[model samples]
Target: MNRRLLVAGLIGIAFAAAAYALMAPAPESTSRPNVAVAVELSPAERGSLVTRRRFAGNLEPAAEFQVAPKVGGQILEVLVDIGDSVARGDIVTRLDDAEFQQSVAQARAELAVAEARLQEAVSAANLATRRLDRIERLEARGVASASELDDASGEAQAQQATVAVTRAQRDQAEAALNSAEVRLGYTRVRADWPGEDETRLVGERMVDAGDTVAANTPLLSIVDIDQLRAVIEVPQSLYGGLAVGDPAQILPPGRPDSEALKARISRISPRFDPESRRTRVELIVDNQDRRLAAGMFVQVGLESRRVEDALIVPRAALVNRQGRQGVFTVAPDADSARFVAVEVALESDDRAALRGVESLDGPVVVLGQDQLTDGAAITRAGQAQRS
Candidate 1:
């Protein structure tokens, strides 16, 4: 009985220990660690936001004209060569006028002959008038027969008719003389342009000396480079916003360091091109220094819109949250940095203009905002402790 009691007491002690182990709680785990995100911050600024629209265009002369000859002949002399400057009424080219001069001389000689014949006709008409008067007087006095008076009258009328015919011939010769003189003047080709200075540059020379060209054949190309035109094709979406006298900036591709040329919208096409769905626009640029030339590719910037004193931030801070676009504004806490999401209104290439978040007065998260949530912890980039 003593041995059995000892064994039962040992078994009871083991069972009690197992029951206590089953009822006991496990030790609590440490709290989750705070999320660390590196961030760059920028201040919200009250500044201006200018919206610019850019387009590619080519420079062209505001006024371009082709010089052609009115009279066909062998080009005797090309007074102006390519790149030469000429003024209005300046002779640019000349044809061989020896033939034309001879024609003029022949016409003058014929005119002189016609004038002499006209004087002779006047004298014969005077004689016929005197004879007719004498015949009338004799017939009235009955000193001449009816047949004699009739013959005298017939002869006088014939002489008058001859005088009239000679007068018409003289008039015809005068017209021929004028026409010949005008033709002779056409041999001297002159440059004609409308301007106070009338000066222009010769862009091309088509014919050389001694080269034969027909009438109305192009001889040279003249352009006024003092003013230039930037021709740009704008898409239909942007065409309606353009108007005459709008300001523009023109930058030459070849000279990037040069200052942008100032221009104004001078023309806009009335119709759009169906194939391109674009409309042509012309900007008048003052090229008084003659730095810009035709056919040079250029970049044009048009001021589309502007907003002054707008709340702006860097574009890098923009983020999309729950289908809404906004920036993460830094909210300072006692020990950590909290990022609050703030929605924005307008955005440009480098900046965004804010609208809804009026309480945002601190720096915005420019970098590392993609891995953030509202009230998320962050540290300024380069300021975090090295582990």
Candidate 2:
């Protein structure tokens, strides 16, 4: 009887629990809270975007050429050496002049002999003319024969022809003397050039004393360092923006603290190199202070045209999504970020020039854009988040 009563009581308690769960009401439905993305923001700005470009090149002498002798001979003395400063008309080298001296003396002697011969011919012509005159007078007075007069006239004419021949010889000898003297002058090779610059430095020495050289062979390399040529090649795209007389600045490679050397465009090649697609441009740099040197690598900086009233932003604020370039803009009081496509008209190292977005009056997401989507919740990095 006791076991039956306990089992009945347990069944009654289970029914009561089932009845209570069946009569309870459903709990109210709730939604999840949205989290804001922390991001660094920068204001969109309007200003002029300047386009600057830099090219690498080397410095070279503006004027350079090899100094060669005008006549061939054995070198006797090299007066100027590499790195030696020389003035206009300065003797750079000397050839063996013994042969030249002998030649000049021989020409002088030949001229003297020709002069004596010409004088003798003139004297004989005068004597013959006087004899001819006496013969003609005697013939007229019937004291001389016709044959004698004819013979006297013929002799005078012959003597005059001899004087003419000797005069020709004398002129030939005088010309030969001038030629010889000019050759003798050639023995002393001079460093000469046509310019206002009176001095230049020898850049190379090709021969030593006692070395035989032919005519027109290079003896030295003379260079003018008063000014230097800065040679840089630019791509076809940048070539159009460059022109003669444009201002430029040159900086030494690996030396940022050095002062920039002022320069201006001097020459621009009309055609681009097919192999490199680059045009050669030359700039003239004054080296009056002699602070720069040839063959040194340098960086040349130049500026192109500027875009006015364009929107600009930091490079970090711009991002590429899919195939479009754009930025994410957020209002000052807004809690979401929105993407806007922009045309990057110009870009420098740290800033970018934008186009066609006049409505960009708000700050752009700079730092946490990679984790953001269009219309995603965002908050300023330093601003407090609302609960």
Candidate 3:
């Protein structure tokens, strides 16, 4: 009876405990709130932004040509050396002219002999004409036979033919003399080309004094340095909008901080290179002060597009979310990022101009956007780091 009483009392106590546990109110605690993500932000701006494409190339002379001689001979003197400035019609090299001079003298002597023979023939022909007249008169008066008159006429005709032949020989001698003089003039090789440039630089000197060379042998390489060509290659995607007058900027080789030089597109190749598939572009850069030189590497910046008065932001701020291209913008008083769809107008390496992001009142997130969701809790990167 004592054990049953103890058991019944314990059961009653357990039932009372269960009843109290069920009746007690739940505690105020629940699930923890979402954690705030740390992100970098930048203020959206309203301005014009340009899409600039920079490429590496080299500075080449505007025009270059090999200077050569017209006749083969020994190089007597090389007047100009490499890096020498020369103008049109400047004599650059000389050849031995002793043989040429002797040839000219011989031609002149031959011409004189031919002239003397022509004069002798003319005198004889004149005498024959007078005799033929006398013979004809004698024949008419029956003082001479017709056969004798015919012989006199035949002799006069033969003398006239001799005069004609001698005159032809004189003309031939004059032509030979002219040819010899021209050849003699070739002994002095001159730098000549057609252009408006007043001067050119000697880029190379191939032959020196006492060097024998054949005709058309290269003596020097002349280059116009007053202007230079900035040659670059662009892929076909950007070649469509390019034109002849497009402006460009030339930066110094391996120097990104240096000032850029102004230039203009002078020529564009119509066809792309078959292997490279890139079109060639040539920009004319003024080197009036001779600041640039040929074969120097440089960077060329070409403006591919322009956006006027558009909303500008860092290119890093742009993101694609849920198949829509936009950026995450967080207001000053807000603790979360909001997705704002924007049309990208112009984009460069580090900046972008958007069409419809101006209405956003907060800065765009530049970093740590991949962890964000619509209305997700966020914290400034600076503030998060400080904490």
Residue-pair clash count for candidate 1: 0
Off by over 4 Å in 3: 1-47, 309-344, 349-351, 356-387
As for lDDT, the candidate ahead, 2 or 3, is 3
Candidate 3: global Cα-lDDT?
0.89
Of the two candidates 1 and 3, the one with more favorable lDDT, higher being better, is 3
**Cα RMSD to the true fold for all candidates:** 7.8, 8.0, 7.2
TM-score of each: 0.72, 0.68, 0.71
Error of 2 at 209 (Å): 1.4
Candidate 2 residue-wise lDDT, 1-387, digit = tens: 999999999999999999999998977769777788999888877887776688999999988878888889999999988788999889989999898899999999999999999999999999999999999999999999999999999999999999999999999999999999999999999988778889988988999999999999999988898899999999988887888999888988776624777899999999899999998999999998878888889999877767888888888888888988899998877889998889998887677888776758478888899888889999788632212
Q: Pick the candidate with the highest TM-score.
A: 1
Candidate with better TM-score, 1 vs 3? 1
Better of 2 and 3 by TM-score: 3
Q: Model 2 — which ten-residue stretch has the worst lDDT?
A: 378-387
lDDT of 2: 0.88
Query: Considering every candidate listed, which one attains the maximal lDDT?
Result: 3
* Model 2 RMSD, rounded to 1 decimal: 8.0
Angstrom error of the Cα, residue 29, model 1: value is 20
- Output the TM-score of candidate 3: 0.71
